[model samples]
Target: MTLHQLRIFWAVAHARSFTKASKVLGLAQPSLSQQISKLEDDVGTQLFNRNRNELELTDAGIFLSRKAELILSSVDETLVGLKEFAEGTRGVIAVGALSSIARILLPRAMHRLSAEFPEVEVDIHETAPAEALELLYGRRLTMAILATDSIASSSVSFHQTEVFSDPYVLAVPRGIDLAQVNDVEADLAEPDRAVVNSTIQFNFGSQHKRRIEAWYQKVLPHYRVIGQTRTYEVALSMVQEGLGVAVVPALTACVGADQSYDVTLYRTSLPDRRLVALTPSQYVRVEPFASCLRHLRETGDDIALPHIEPGPPLMKAL
Candidate 1:
């Protein structure tokens, strides 16, 4: 008859015992029984068959339990919708991104978001760009910051905002001597003479994979990729151990030397990387969504990206 009575009835029906339901509802067993009895009287049917220590829901009880579940779930979802509508500043926003980007960029953006809008919460999912896009399309994430070159064909439509461009950099062991290549530009132009033979590979997708392979053929003809990794940090670490040079996006390299270890950076002439923010078209202009994007662009603009220097192993970037 009442929502409260329905709640009690549903709990007991699921628990299958008056005593168990009483414990779950934190009510006295007799009080719980009385309420259910009152409800059965209102419905003009027996809701439960109570045995000594066991309980069974009658046909009516089973029907009501199913109805209660639907009612409660709908009520909960409605409340969440209303809360989001009224409060543009509060609640959680789910974001998916590459781990390296999440490390370097997300930290700063989250800090700023928290400082400016204390009520909102950011939930970050560290994943590959392609996988992140899948999550975005699936509605698991509201937004994703990643490269979009891998999504070949999909029915999912999303609005992509290019936040920044990242260049490819070779992560070499710090101890390697670059004196062999007198003309740095010429060496990258012809990989046949580039001295570093061992290399580490970071695979994003088939398209990215083929592009990297082409770059290697054009720049490091004699080089052999010793190991394959999914993350730039791992590739950088392998390079630090004197394994081989790793070609990674500057976005990952600029994450700092902690994960990079003893790796030194070298500028490569390969295609520059694209970093984009993909959002559902409907929410792209919405607040907090709009403000979150503003923070991303702000941090991106101020980043001190590293690059290949002419004289040494490090180059300053935008």
Candidate 2:
């Protein structure tokens, strides 16, 4: 009956548990149950049926959940529009982005955003692409910025704008110099060769993982995966510690304007990682969100990527 009740029901339906919904909404399970009970009473029908311990939506619940999604999305967009017009861009815009991109680009983008609209505020959520999409669909995030290849093709139905393309480069310990070595197998010493052949792999995005696997197989035929990680920062840090080498986006190894990393970067034949801003089509025409997207693009354009030397011929081929 109320928007609050609809939100609670929506969360419960998505989460499939009153307890989990409570954690997400920051409310008690009893409170959520009470609201859902009141909602079922107002509708004059039971919405959910508990099968064993799991909650399953009834026919009525399925219909209401679909309608609630549309209603809530429209209400949130309208509120954003009205606030921008009434308060002159004095409002918070919740954004979800990968940690590295957030750390490297958001600060400058926000600096520009604040200069233009000093009253505006940004709420950033550092998350992976899947979680970012989840938050975006739940109306907890107004926009999400991430790599276009990070999420499955079927999951990207929202409007997206290309922000920038980051080249994938190989990160090796500072001690191993790739610039002087033409053949990884023949030119490097035994220890350095072992370091080059020992790869630290990433285990997210099926397409990306497959491509990286094939690249390693072709580039280093006898290579072995010594470690795996989900974050680029951790992978690069491991390389800095001489654990193993990794292929990562150039921006991930960069700290602020003048900061540098101990690892060395070498350009590879790998395709560039295209970063994009994803939002509902309606938000594209809305204020503040539109401006924020522009700022993201501008910030990406101005970035000075860390120096990446050309890889050896054997490493660059295939």
Q: Estimate each model's TM-score.
A: 0.65, 0.83
| Highest TM-score model number | 2
Please give the lDDT score for candidate 2. Answer: 0.84
Q: Count the clashes in each prediction.
A: 3, 0
Candidate 1, run of 10 with poorest lDDT? 309-318
Model 2 agreement with the true structure over 134-250: per-residue lDDT tens digits: 666556777888887875564455678888888899999998888767677888888999999999987777888899999888888888999988888889989999988999999
Against the true structure, whose lDDT is highest?
A: 2
lDDT of 2 at 183: 73
How many pairs of residues in model 1 come into backbone collision?
3
Model 2 scores a TM of 0.83
- Which digits, one per residue and each the tens of the lDDT, describe model 1 over residues 3-55? 77887886677566777667556689999989998999999999888787788
Which whole-number lDDT from 0 to 100 does residue 124 have in model 2? 95
Question: What's the true lDDT of residue 239 in model 1?
Answer: 73
